[model samples]
Target: MIVKKTDNGLVMDFPALPYHKIEWSPQLQALNLKQPCVIAPYWCDRLGTPSIKARQGGRRQGELLCEIKGNRVLLYGSCHLYLKGTIYLP
Candidate 1:
Protein backbone atom coordinates (compact mmCIF):
# COMPACT_ATOMS: atom_id res chain seq x y z
CA MET A 1 0.00 0.00 0.00
CA ILE A 2 1.05 3.62 -0.54
CA VAL A 3 -0.03 6.95 0.89
CA LYS A 4 -0.41 9.79 -1.57
CA LYS A 5 -2.58 12.82 -2.34
CA THR A 6 -4.88 12.90 -5.27
CA ASP A 7 -6.22 15.99 -7.08
CA ASN A 8 -8.14 17.03 -3.97
CA GLY A 9 -7.47 14.91 -0.90
CA LEU A 10 -5.08 12.28 0.44
CA VAL A 11 -5.61 8.67 -0.55
CA MET A 12 -4.28 5.32 0.60
CA ASP A 13 -4.00 3.04 -2.37
CA PHE A 14 -4.19 -0.66 -1.51
CA PRO A 15 -2.52 -3.18 -3.80
CA ALA A 16 -3.63 -6.38 -2.14
CA LEU A 17 -7.35 -5.89 -2.82
CA PRO A 18 -8.76 -6.76 -6.21
CA TYR A 19 -7.83 -4.05 -8.74
CA HIS A 20 -11.31 -3.97 -10.21
CA LYS A 21 -12.71 -2.49 -6.99
CA ILE A 22 -10.94 0.79 -7.69
CA GLU A 23 -9.36 0.55 -11.10
CA TRP A 24 -9.91 3.90 -12.84
CA SER A 25 -12.53 4.54 -10.22
CA PRO A 26 -10.50 7.22 -8.39
CA GLN A 27 -11.97 5.62 -5.28
CA LEU A 28 -8.64 4.80 -3.71
CA GLN A 29 -10.17 3.24 -0.60
CA ALA A 30 -12.93 3.23 2.02
CA LEU A 31 -12.88 3.14 5.82
CA ASN A 32 -14.85 0.86 8.11
CA LEU A 33 -16.63 3.45 10.19
CA LYS A 34 -19.83 3.37 12.29
CA GLN A 35 -21.63 6.67 11.65
CA PRO A 36 -23.28 8.88 9.08
CA CYS A 37 -20.95 11.45 7.48
CA VAL A 38 -22.39 14.57 5.93
CA ILE A 39 -20.90 15.35 2.57
CA ALA A 40 -19.88 18.85 1.63
CA PRO A 41 -21.28 20.69 -1.36
CA TYR A 42 -18.15 20.32 -3.44
CA TRP A 43 -17.77 16.64 -4.24
CA CYS A 44 -17.37 14.43 -7.29
CA ASP A 45 -18.77 10.94 -7.46
CA ARG A 46 -17.43 8.15 -9.62
CA LEU A 47 -19.15 7.91 -13.02
CA GLY A 48 -21.14 4.86 -11.98
CA THR A 49 -20.28 4.85 -8.30
CA PRO A 50 -22.85 7.26 -6.87
CA SER A 51 -21.87 5.93 -3.45
CA ILE A 52 -18.33 7.30 -3.97
CA LYS A 53 -17.41 10.97 -4.24
CA ALA A 54 -14.50 13.37 -3.96
CA ARG A 55 -15.21 15.64 -1.00
CA GLN A 56 -13.91 19.17 -0.59
CA GLY A 57 -11.99 20.85 2.30
CA GLY A 58 -8.62 19.41 1.30
CA ARG A 59 -6.17 19.16 -1.53
CA ARG A 60 -9.20 18.11 -3.61
CA GLN A 61 -12.96 17.79 -3.58
CA GLY A 62 -12.87 14.03 -3.42
CA GLU A 63 -10.57 14.35 -0.48
CA LEU A 64 -13.67 13.39 1.41
CA LEU A 65 -14.51 10.90 -1.27
CA CYS A 66 -12.19 8.57 0.53
CA GLU A 67 -14.69 8.67 3.34
CA ILE A 68 -17.66 7.66 1.23
CA LYS A 69 -20.81 7.68 3.42
CA GLY A 70 -18.61 7.14 6.50
CA ASN A 71 -20.76 4.08 7.21
CA ARG A 72 -18.35 1.52 5.70
CA VAL A 73 -15.43 3.69 4.66
CA LEU A 74 -13.11 5.76 6.78
CA LEU A 75 -10.59 7.30 4.43
CA TYR A 76 -7.22 8.15 5.90
CA GLY A 77 -5.16 11.26 5.45
CA SER A 78 -2.42 10.43 7.95
CA CYS A 79 -2.91 6.67 8.38
CA HIS A 80 -2.19 3.40 6.61
CA LEU A 81 -4.33 0.61 5.21
CA TYR A 82 -5.96 -2.06 7.38
CA LEU A 83 -7.10 -5.29 5.81
CA LYS A 84 -9.45 -7.67 7.55
CA GLY A 85 -9.13 -5.57 10.71
CA THR A 86 -5.37 -6.16 10.59
CA ILE A 87 -2.57 -3.99 9.25
CA TYR A 88 0.30 -6.12 7.95
CA LEU A 89 3.32 -4.44 6.48
CA PRO A 90 7.02 -5.04 5.87
Candidate 2:
Protein backbone atom coordinates (compact mmCIF):
# COMPACT_ATOMS: atom_id res chain seq x y z
CA MET A 1 0.00 0.00 0.00
CA ILE A 2 1.13 3.51 -0.70
CA VAL A 3 -0.08 6.59 1.12
CA LYS A 4 0.30 10.10 -0.17
CA LYS A 5 -0.81 13.45 1.11
CA THR A 6 -2.03 15.87 -1.51
CA ASP A 7 -3.23 19.42 -1.31
CA ASN A 8 -6.84 18.30 -1.23
CA GLY A 9 -6.71 15.05 0.69
CA LEU A 10 -4.83 11.85 1.33
CA VAL A 11 -4.47 9.20 -1.33
CA MET A 12 -4.15 5.46 -0.74
CA ASP A 13 -3.08 3.15 -3.53
CA PHE A 14 -3.30 -0.60 -3.40
CA PRO A 15 -3.38 -3.50 -5.79
CA ALA A 16 -6.73 -4.60 -7.07
CA LEU A 17 -8.42 -7.30 -5.04
CA PRO A 18 -11.73 -8.61 -3.89
CA TYR A 19 -13.90 -6.43 -1.70
CA HIS A 20 -17.02 -7.23 0.22
CA LYS A 21 -19.47 -5.80 2.67
CA ILE A 22 -20.91 -7.62 5.64
CA GLU A 23 -24.34 -6.48 6.61
CA TRP A 24 -25.14 -6.44 10.29
CA SER A 25 -27.41 -9.20 11.39
CA PRO A 26 -30.17 -8.42 13.81
CA GLN A 27 -28.05 -9.75 16.64
CA LEU A 28 -25.10 -7.61 15.59
CA GLN A 29 -27.32 -4.56 15.17
CA ALA A 30 -28.48 -5.01 18.72
CA LEU A 31 -24.85 -4.96 19.84
CA ASN A 32 -23.78 -1.93 17.81
CA LEU A 33 -25.60 0.12 15.21
CA LYS A 34 -23.46 3.21 14.93
CA GLN A 35 -20.82 1.82 12.60
CA PRO A 36 -20.96 -0.15 9.38
CA CYS A 37 -18.31 -2.66 8.40
CA VAL A 38 -16.67 -3.56 5.12
CA ILE A 39 -13.84 -5.89 4.30
CA ALA A 40 -10.98 -5.22 1.91
CA PRO A 41 -8.66 -8.11 1.24
CA TYR A 42 -5.80 -5.86 0.18
CA TRP A 43 -6.18 -3.68 3.20
CA CYS A 44 -6.40 -6.68 5.46
CA ASP A 45 -3.10 -7.94 4.13
CA ARG A 46 -1.52 -4.57 4.81
CA LEU A 47 -2.46 -4.54 8.46
CA GLY A 48 0.48 -3.50 10.58
CA THR A 49 1.46 -4.72 13.98
CA PRO A 50 0.25 -2.84 17.01
CA SER A 51 3.79 -2.27 18.18
CA ILE A 52 7.18 -2.18 16.47
CA LYS A 53 10.77 -1.76 17.76
CA ALA A 54 13.57 -0.96 15.29
CA ARG A 55 16.30 1.46 14.33
CA GLN A 56 16.97 3.34 11.05
CA GLY A 57 19.52 5.41 9.10
CA GLY A 58 23.18 5.95 10.15
CA ARG A 59 24.88 4.15 13.01
CA ARG A 60 23.94 6.93 15.39
CA GLN A 61 20.26 6.74 14.42
CA GLY A 62 17.63 6.17 17.05
CA GLU A 63 14.89 3.59 16.93
CA LEU A 64 11.75 4.01 14.79
CA LEU A 65 8.66 2.54 16.31
CA CYS A 66 5.16 2.33 14.86
CA GLU A 67 1.83 1.20 16.18
CA ILE A 68 -1.61 0.71 14.70
CA LYS A 69 -4.75 0.77 16.77
CA GLY A 70 -8.20 0.87 15.25
CA ASN A 71 -7.96 3.76 12.78
CA ARG A 72 -4.99 5.47 14.34
CA VAL A 73 -1.35 5.14 13.24
CA LEU A 74 1.24 6.10 15.82
CA LEU A 75 5.00 6.49 15.72
CA TYR A 76 7.52 6.95 18.47
CA GLY A 77 11.30 7.07 18.73
CA SER A 78 13.40 10.19 18.84
CA CYS A 79 10.11 11.96 18.20
CA HIS A 80 6.42 11.18 18.53
CA LEU A 81 3.73 11.53 15.89
CA TYR A 82 0.33 10.07 15.12
CA LEU A 83 -2.47 10.19 12.59
CA LYS A 84 -5.92 9.83 14.06
CA GLY A 85 -9.24 10.44 12.33
CA THR A 86 -11.88 8.96 10.08
CA ILE A 87 -11.61 7.73 6.49
CA TYR A 88 -14.40 7.27 4.01
CA LEU A 89 -14.33 4.70 1.22
CA PRO A 90 -16.70 3.88 -1.54
Candidate 3:
Protein backbone atom coordinates (compact mmCIF):
# COMPACT_ATOMS: atom_id res chain seq x y z
CA MET A 1 0.00 0.00 0.00
CA ILE A 2 1.13 3.53 -0.78
CA VAL A 3 0.40 6.02 1.95
CA LYS A 4 0.79 9.76 1.59
CA LYS A 5 0.84 12.22 4.43
CA THR A 6 -1.62 15.01 3.89
CA ASP A 7 -2.27 18.17 5.81
CA ASN A 8 -5.51 16.78 7.14
CA GLY A 9 -4.30 13.21 7.70
CA LEU A 10 -3.06 10.37 5.54
CA VAL A 11 -4.23 9.08 2.21
CA MET A 12 -3.73 5.37 1.60
CA ASP A 13 -3.66 3.71 -1.76
CA PHE A 14 -4.05 0.02 -2.32
CA PRO A 15 -5.29 -2.29 -5.01
CA ALA A 16 -8.40 -4.29 -4.24
CA LEU A 17 -10.82 -6.47 -6.08
CA PRO A 18 -14.55 -6.72 -5.80
CA TYR A 19 -15.79 -8.12 -2.49
CA HIS A 20 -12.45 -7.41 -0.91
CA LYS A 21 -12.58 -7.42 2.87
CA ILE A 22 -10.26 -5.22 4.90
CA GLU A 23 -9.89 -5.72 8.61
CA TRP A 24 -8.34 -3.24 10.97
CA SER A 25 -5.65 -4.23 13.39
CA PRO A 26 -5.98 -3.70 17.11
CA GLN A 27 -3.18 -1.17 17.17
CA LEU A 28 -4.74 0.88 14.40
CA GLN A 29 -8.11 0.76 16.08
CA ALA A 30 -6.63 2.01 19.33
CA LEU A 31 -5.09 4.93 17.52
CA ASN A 32 -8.30 6.16 15.92
CA LEU A 33 -11.17 5.57 18.20
CA LYS A 34 -14.13 7.82 17.42
CA GLN A 35 -12.01 9.59 14.86
CA PRO A 36 -13.36 10.27 11.42
CA CYS A 37 -11.54 9.12 8.28
CA VAL A 38 -12.18 9.01 4.58
CA ILE A 39 -11.80 6.12 2.12
CA ALA A 40 -11.92 6.43 -1.61
CA PRO A 41 -11.26 4.31 -4.66
CA TYR A 42 -8.67 5.51 -7.12
CA TRP A 43 -8.10 4.23 -10.63
CA CYS A 44 -10.49 1.38 -10.25
CA ASP A 45 -11.17 -0.92 -13.13
CA ARG A 46 -14.88 -0.97 -12.51
CA LEU A 47 -17.36 0.78 -10.33
CA GLY A 48 -18.31 -0.75 -6.99
CA THR A 49 -20.65 0.07 -4.11
CA PRO A 50 -19.41 -0.57 -0.61
CA SER A 51 -21.20 -0.67 2.72
CA ILE A 52 -20.01 -0.33 6.26
CA LYS A 53 -21.49 -2.24 9.18
CA ALA A 54 -20.92 -2.48 12.88
CA ARG A 55 -20.77 -5.78 14.69
CA GLN A 56 -21.19 -6.74 18.29
CA GLY A 57 -21.35 -10.04 20.23
CA GLY A 58 -20.44 -12.05 17.15
CA ARG A 59 -23.48 -10.83 15.29
CA ARG A 60 -23.44 -8.48 12.33
CA GLN A 61 -25.48 -5.36 12.54
CA GLY A 62 -27.38 -3.73 9.73
CA GLU A 63 -25.39 -2.47 6.78
CA LEU A 64 -24.78 1.24 6.69
CA LEU A 65 -26.43 2.45 3.55
CA CYS A 66 -24.18 3.94 0.84
CA GLU A 67 -23.95 4.38 -2.87
CA ILE A 68 -20.91 4.77 -5.15
CA LYS A 69 -21.06 5.70 -8.78
CA GLY A 70 -18.32 6.95 -11.03
CA ASN A 71 -16.36 9.47 -9.00
CA ARG A 72 -19.08 10.33 -6.52
CA VAL A 73 -19.71 8.77 -3.15
CA LEU A 74 -23.02 9.18 -1.34
CA LEU A 75 -23.62 8.10 2.21
CA TYR A 76 -27.20 7.90 3.43
CA GLY A 77 -26.58 6.26 6.77
CA SER A 78 -24.47 7.22 9.74
CA CYS A 79 -21.40 5.73 8.09
CA HIS A 80 -18.93 7.58 5.88
CA LEU A 81 -17.39 7.00 2.48
CA TYR A 82 -15.55 8.96 -0.13
CA LEU A 83 -15.30 7.13 -3.47
CA LYS A 84 -16.11 3.63 -2.27
CA GLY A 85 -15.28 2.57 1.19
CA THR A 86 -16.64 0.51 4.04
CA ILE A 87 -15.84 0.00 7.68
CA TYR A 88 -16.46 -3.16 9.70
CA LEU A 89 -16.21 -3.23 13.43
CA PRO A 90 -15.84 -6.24 15.60
Candidate 4:
Protein backbone atom coordinates (compact mmCIF):
# COMPACT_ATOMS: atom_id res chain seq x y z
CA MET A 1 0.00 0.00 0.00
CA ILE A 2 1.09 3.55 -0.72
CA VAL A 3 0.17 6.88 0.79
CA LYS A 4 -0.94 9.64 -1.54
CA LYS A 5 -2.71 12.95 -1.30
CA THR A 6 -6.23 12.95 -2.79
CA ASP A 7 -8.40 16.02 -3.01
CA ASN A 8 -6.15 17.56 -0.39
CA GLY A 9 -6.64 14.55 1.89
CA LEU A 10 -4.31 11.65 2.65
CA VAL A 11 -5.53 8.42 1.09
CA MET A 12 -4.30 4.86 0.87
CA ASP A 13 -3.89 2.81 -2.29
CA PHE A 14 -4.60 -0.66 -1.03
CA PRO A 15 -3.66 -3.67 -3.14
CA ALA A 16 -6.72 -5.55 -2.00
CA LEU A 17 -9.63 -6.98 -3.94
CA PRO A 18 -12.82 -5.00 -4.47
CA TYR A 19 -15.15 -6.81 -2.13
CA HIS A 20 -18.75 -5.97 -2.95
CA LYS A 21 -21.52 -7.01 -0.64
CA ILE A 22 -23.11 -10.29 -1.75
CA GLU A 23 -26.08 -10.34 0.56
CA TRP A 24 -25.06 -11.38 4.03
CA SER A 25 -26.95 -13.98 6.06
CA PRO A 26 -27.38 -13.74 9.81
CA GLN A 27 -24.48 -16.11 10.29
CA LEU A 28 -22.26 -14.08 7.98
CA GLN A 29 -23.25 -10.84 9.64
CA ALA A 30 -22.34 -12.28 13.01
CA LEU A 31 -18.87 -13.00 11.75
CA ASN A 32 -18.40 -9.77 9.77
CA LEU A 33 -19.71 -7.66 12.61
CA LYS A 34 -16.49 -8.52 14.38
CA GLN A 35 -14.54 -6.59 11.76
CA PRO A 36 -12.73 -8.28 8.90
CA CYS A 37 -13.87 -11.77 8.07
CA VAL A 38 -12.50 -14.47 5.84
CA ILE A 39 -13.98 -14.49 2.36
CA ALA A 40 -15.74 -17.66 1.36
CA PRO A 41 -14.12 -19.99 -1.15
CA TYR A 42 -16.67 -19.21 -3.88
CA TRP A 43 -16.92 -15.50 -3.15
CA CYS A 44 -15.00 -13.65 -5.81
CA ASP A 45 -14.98 -10.97 -8.50
CA ARG A 46 -13.02 -11.36 -11.74
CA LEU A 47 -12.35 -7.67 -12.41
CA GLY A 48 -11.88 -6.95 -8.78
CA THR A 49 -8.10 -7.07 -9.04
CA PRO A 50 -7.54 -5.19 -12.27
CA SER A 51 -4.58 -2.90 -12.79
CA ILE A 52 -4.51 0.47 -11.03
CA LYS A 53 -2.56 3.62 -11.75
CA ALA A 54 -0.95 5.54 -8.94
CA ARG A 55 -0.09 9.23 -9.02
CA GLN A 56 3.48 8.37 -9.95
CA GLY A 57 4.06 5.83 -12.70
CA GLY A 58 6.45 2.82 -12.84
CA ARG A 59 5.00 1.01 -9.82
CA ARG A 60 2.52 -1.88 -9.96
CA GLN A 61 -0.84 -1.49 -8.27
CA GLY A 62 -4.27 -3.03 -8.28
CA GLU A 63 -7.71 -1.55 -8.87
CA LEU A 64 -8.19 1.59 -6.78
CA LEU A 65 -11.93 1.72 -7.03
CA CYS A 66 -13.96 -0.38 -4.59
CA GLU A 67 -17.17 -0.10 -2.59
CA ILE A 68 -16.36 1.83 0.58
CA LYS A 69 -19.68 1.18 2.25
CA GLY A 70 -23.20 -0.15 1.65
CA ASN A 71 -22.40 -3.34 -0.19
CA ARG A 72 -18.65 -2.80 0.11
CA VAL A 73 -15.90 -3.68 2.51
CA LEU A 74 -15.34 -1.21 5.34
CA LEU A 75 -11.68 -0.23 5.55
CA TYR A 76 -9.88 1.20 8.56
CA GLY A 77 -6.40 2.57 9.10
CA SER A 78 -4.40 5.83 9.11
CA CYS A 79 -7.40 7.22 7.21
CA HIS A 80 -10.94 5.89 7.16
CA LEU A 81 -12.03 5.59 3.54
CA TYR A 82 -15.08 3.68 2.49
CA LEU A 83 -14.05 1.11 -0.10
CA LYS A 84 -15.03 2.61 -3.45
CA GLY A 85 -14.43 1.45 -7.00
CA THR A 86 -12.25 3.10 -9.58
CA ILE A 87 -13.72 5.29 -12.29
CA TYR A 88 -13.98 4.18 -15.90
CA LEU A 89 -10.66 3.83 -17.67
CA PRO A 90 -9.90 5.84 -20.77
Q: Pick the candidate with the highest TM-score.
A: 2
Task: Compose the digit string of candidate 4's lDDT tens values, residues 1-90.
Answer: 454456844333323322375443322333344322222111223224312222211232222222234345433222233368878988
Which regions of candidate 4 fall more than 4 Å away from where they truly are? Answer: 8-10, 15-60, 74-90
Candidates arranged by lDDT, highest first: 2, 1, 3, 4
Against the unseen true structure, what C-alpha lDDT does each candidate score? Answer: 0.33, 0.35, 0.32, 0.31
By TM-score, how accurate is candidate 2?
0.30
Q: Give model 1's clash tally.
A: 10
Poorly placed runs, candidate 3 (over 4 Å): 1-37, 40-63, 78-90
* Candidate that would win on lDDT: 2
Which segments of candidate 1 are over 4 A away from where they belong?
18-64, 68-90
What pairs collide in candidate 1? 8-59, 8-60, 9-60, 31-73, 31-74, 54-61, 54-62, 55-61, 55-62, 55-65
Lowest summed lDDT across 10 adjacent residues in model 3 is found at 54-63
For candidate 2, the C-alpha RMSD (Å) to the true structure equals 17.6
> In every candidate, how many clashes are there?
10, 0, 0, 10
Deviating ranges (above 4 Å) for candidate 2? 1-48, 79-90
Give the per-residue lDDT of model 1 (tens digit) for 1-90: 344456954443332222444332222332322111333211314232333333223232223333444334444433334345667899
TM-score of each: 0.22, 0.30, 0.22, 0.21
Whole-model lDDT, model 1 = 0.33
Give one digit per residue, the lDDT tens place, for model 3 in 1-90: 454455844333333222224443322231234211234333122223243221111122221223346555443333333257678999
Determine which window of 10 residues in candidate 1 has minimal summed lDDT: 33-42
